[model samples]
Target: MQKCGLTEKSPGQYVDTIATDAYVWYEENWQHDEYDHSHQRYQLTYVEEGYQYFHIEKKIYLVPQNHVIWIPTGKEHRTTSEAKTVNLMLVLFKSVSELEFYQNVHVFSAPAVLKEMLRYASKWNKVLTEDTEQQIFLQAIQNSLPHFCKESSGLQIPVPTDSRLIPICSYINANYQYHFDSDVLADKAKMSIRSLQRIFKQETGITLQKYMQLIRILKSIELIDTQQFTLSEIAFKVGYQSLPAFTSSYYAIMKTKPKLKR
Candidate 1:
């Protein structure tokens, strides 16, 4: 996604609010590009299946299955997914208050109930009001969203202000899910414990342990949200030996539990 002034440019026309929903988009456009925007009535998304990649405010991200990209109000952001991806996206303008809480960007897992609503909302163009079936699905979607938008605090690691942590930061951003620890990371940065620790937090707004925890939670969210991984599998995958500790930390950050679908 490239950054620009606010305005979404799409070749196809979308459903207007009176017709069914404010908008319901389900299609594949490989070379897709959306113009920038300051704010909108509502923005929500669902990843049916596929590998989702996005670069919001210059930071690259992976949005996998059961993923929801909720762009609050109008924060200029752009995104695209590759082939082999099936997604359901909806924009509701009539009810949501006009407020954008995120100044930068955030990536969050779509809760289970919202995932089900995406499945339902994808059924028709404006089935939301038609009472075709699951008429309450819209309410479910709205209710499931947080009353006050969360600050852009999803899985994000700070870039070292010191400039020395660049290589290591890149590695961690690229390999957060892989098995590695501070010693290995320190080696990658060509620094020892005390030096790396001092610079890492000063630049990143977090300690090494906290930073690793962020990586662990991020990897876990991707697995739990997109790939079909049991929490136990995710814990091990993120280098957590004790499942209970990982669970506690995950909840502290996401405020949600991990429950993968069968």
Candidate 2:
């Protein structure tokens, strides 16, 4: 909570770091909220833990661990987290940036070094510099980024044509209010539990349970920010059955408690 707090982001409001093309915020307790973006900005998010959904181009992308989702300039995008999520952000503008030569979604196994670099950035330490030395450090990250990943071939999931997992996925999407487990998901997907687990990790880079958490976190975030329900109301709405469990999960994802206005 000490490191993750109000400085990161606040509901219905946005922070502008006018001085630097880079901005980073780690909400140790970065809770759920839907935010609208304007002008043009690109983001590289490392999901330290928890779940997140990116609403972009009429598609919903579930972002999980070692998992990074990048949104390019002028793209209408929104982010919501259900778990206590550690968010490492590298936001840049088209003008002051060198990433223009690259485009489209890039997903690679985040290198241990890049993970360390992002860890440094997400520290919420305000002492970062655009100094010649610091610039090289940052550039090293940017230059090395586009190469680690080849083109996606427009596939987010690696489900085989013969895979029967779609039915299970559809059921989970429809019944997210209920608790999900590997056995249940496997039954629904009509694959052996072990195979379902393997394919899920291969396809989404995370387990089925992780994806479910992302969905719950997204639902909780929407309700909390919109005030469509009281804390307890949203808790049960997202299948927590209790406020403490929901809060615990929320804080676990965001690394901070939801600020209640007096």
Relative to the true structure, how large is the alpha-carbon lDDT of every model?
0.58, 0.58
Off-target runs (Cα >4 Å) in candidate 2 are 1-17, 84-87, 91-101, 122-124, 127-129, 150-172, 175-262
Please report, as a residue range, the 10-residue window in candidate 2 with the lowest summed lDDT.
1-10
What tens-digit string does per-residue lDDT give for candidate 1 at 1-262?
Answer: 2211123344322223244434445543233454333444456655565535555553445555655566554445455554344444554443453334332244566756666666666665443355635435665565566642343364454545465787887777677666676788888888897889888777766787777677677667656655556788888888777788778888876666666656
Cα lDDT for residue 82, candidate 2: 55
Segments of candidate 1 deviating more than 4 angstroms? 1-21, 27-42, 46-54, 58-67, 72-86, 92-152, 157-163, 173-187, 190-195, 224-231
- Sequence-dependent TM-score of model 1: 0.57
List model 2 lDDT by residue over 1-262, tens digit each. Answer: 1121122343434354445455455544555447654334455666665546666653566564555666665666666655533454443533334456345555444668778887765543444345665555655666667766543222243332334766766676678789766787787777799988888777656578766765676566555545456778888888888888878877765455544322
* Each prediction's RMSD to truth: 6.6, 11.4
TM-score of 2: 0.50
